[model samples]
Target: MTTLQWTPRTDAPRALVVRDGHARLGPAQATEMFLPFLEQAGFEVQVAESSEIYADRAVMERTDLIVQCVATSAISDAALRGLLDAVEHGTGLAGWHRGIADAYRNSSDYLQLIGGQFVSRPAAPDEERGTDESDRSRCYTVDLTDEGRTHEIMAGLEDFTLRTEPYWVLTDDLNDVLATTTYAARPDDPWHRPITSPAVWTRRWGDGRVFVATPGHSLVVLRDAHVRAIIQRGMLWASRPAAAA
Candidate 1:
């Protein structure tokens, strides 16, 4: 692992492109609500309505932090290559909920890169079934692991609750699990066992860093003071140090 020096400001303006075509939430919601959050965090943000531009190598190269708020969708081979290349060369990548975990579902290479995927949930079936954003449930407790407490990204954080989706992820190669949520078995479900699912994690592929959190199913989750702080630190932590790059 390489140590990244903390800087007052990032080198280039970061871009947060919300892919409207594939997102469960429409473009207006993402652009109006989500983009502002990044801009407020001090990044020069741009919201791309479509993913077509991602295919251009030059466009991908110029980006520093690429935040994909899109759900599962097909991407051109060129686009996939471009995004992967940017990360390999030291660009940071961060996303929460299905924006990333479920994005590019068909690409095994993509899944492997991100470290996991959304398969199914047993504890909160009703919340999963509801399409209305308001119908989503909240207020779940997350346990931060030892690894999580030591990391700079998790600095000054403790077990916190967020009004967001409780994620049941299918993962194997998570480098470090910063936080987790416990699930109790329901009568309808076959598995009656309790399991701890990773709520936040970080992985490295080549030179790039990938940080993921399964909590951001709604704007409320994103707006939580603790959640916002974690994401802000995560973006900075995930980016390659300027010297390393």
Candidate 2:
């Protein structure tokens, strides 16, 4: 597989705004990794530290792409409105794991825009103490579908393995499934029998595009060769198209 070479758009540099709304996972680390990645990929990235993204009017209007690292929570009314309006008019939004899925847990409008949520992880028993430093992390293999192999976002990538939390999401509105992981229930398990969980998918919400991957729980997972490629492509694909909506 040839390494992708990005060609810059001359009309105006593609602008990407990243919001670290949840503050669960360290916000500093999220910005450090993603900002450089977007810059190298030919985008002008602006990092926002506020929980309320819509509060910044200038950033909201100029943003061509929004990468939200926020978990489920109450966002300001203006923030929600700005984000929804931006996407409706054509601004791409993308994120991996709980950042997008767990965001705005109580808002139906937010869910409608992103297309899904983190319902439950049936395979793993609910940890009473919640995810912490000592939670057992394991290695898992990801299988890319034929469609994944053909899509630009996943093109040239081979099946790869990574060590992280294998999130089992429940969603029915996904449009294009690029990759999935196989999960087998333990003999003592009481929830699900066995299931294949989607690790990556693309969905359309209004005029904007939503790309999500359930694999980016740790920095190690994001830095993996195949994982990095998938994310890089997904970010580019999720950005609002360079045409009038």
Candidate 3:
């Protein structure tokens, strides 16, 4: 039998921001955009140097939410276990783009926790290339599902278009998909049919919640009002709720 120790919840929730990973938007930019918003939302925000802090049980115990922007990085077994344990105990986890979807490539545990993995973002065939490579950054719409329109994080939001890297992710049915984007097959592409991927989703992990929005490739994308609102709200939605007084 395993014994669960009690940890007190604070009035102002704590948010741990992990920005360690290779990305076009460095840690500074990502932190700059997110830190202030978190503070304004009444969170005691801390930007972690690396994923190592995930193993800090003392810190994890008080943590109400984790906003991770790590991409293509490695997480130690201890750290991964700590993170999973924290969430399993009620701490929230949320991220956008490669932050959550493209991270911890080697950890099946992390993948299972998040419920999705980045496969590839198929680009237009070489023959379709333009001098400016407009085909590469094609515009596409993120269509909202019925649930999305009513979901707390995306309530009253309408379908929106963005011209950025359209992600093609491999996701599980466990996710409550809120929005999606479809990739059209080009003549030069091998696939004969369209490929649709989840643009935004949420998952229930034990007592915690996980939120992912696969659109923030650049600060420009993150600046989109819809994207910004979703990410901000998602962080809050995923956080551990305060205990009754």
Candidate 4:
């Protein structure tokens, strides 16, 4: 992948948004939805087609925030190192759904940076073989954790229901879990009990911050007021402080 070129700026904080679409969602839709918001927040936003832009060490060093939406893509070693180094040096990283959780399957460092991995979305027991994959989403509730009630990003948000993919993620204690969703095991499920996974989380990686949310599977889900607020706030909360930037 070729590195994207851009002139570095000092007037305002910079945000690097990497967008790549797969299946139902398109980069255009995601960009259209988030670009204006970033700009309005006084950020100098640079849109990239791939994570390869991470290879530009000069730009990455000045970037205050990165909002990536690419899924299931492999990032080159130099690019991956550049990204991790940028974040470790105080750049903020934020993403939603597969964009963060399911991305970079080959890179353990990337996984450690984000602090979560997409595992599986077990189908409902009533779901039949050969069922239309698009309509398989079921309604589930996202309940805030105790810390989430006071956390700046999740404060005052009530438990909300979303009819979308219920992600079962693999995460460690390093994450500061803000919200969660429970998967009730039906009789047919291999696991005999309920399982809960982090629906939203934040982590401190060196001098930087990382934010992840698991509910954004489509444009509709992303448009939900609660979901949108969480993501937007998460981005801001993860961004390098204006003074620091």
Query: Which candidate number would show the highest TM-score if scored against the true structure?
Result: 3
The residue ranges of model 4 lying beyond 4 angstroms of the native Cα positions read: 1-10, 21-23, 125-134
Better of 1 and 4 by lDDT: 4
Model 2: runs farther than 4 Å from truth? 1-11, 21-24, 55-57, 122-133
The candidate, 1 or 2, that scores higher on TM-score is 2
Clashes of 1: 0
By TM-score, the better pick of 2 and 4 is: 4
- Clash pairs detected, candidate 4: none
What is the C-alpha lDDT profile of model 4 across 82-142, one tens digit per residue? 8988888788999999988999999999999999998989675475334676565887889
- Residue range with the least summed lDDT across 10 consecutive positions in model 3: 1-10
Candidate 3 structure, TM-score to reference:
0.93
lDDT of each: 0.72, 0.71, 0.87, 0.87
Instruction: Provide TM-scores for the models.
Output: 0.82, 0.83, 0.93, 0.92
Q: Where does model 3 exceed 4 Å of error? A: 1-4, 125-129, 132-135
TM-score, predicted candidate 2 vs. hidden true structure: 0.83
Q: RMSD, each candidate, Å?
A: 5.3, 7.0, 2.3, 3.5
Quick one: ranking by lDDT, best first?
Answer: 4, 3, 1, 2
List clashing residue pairs in candidate 3.
none
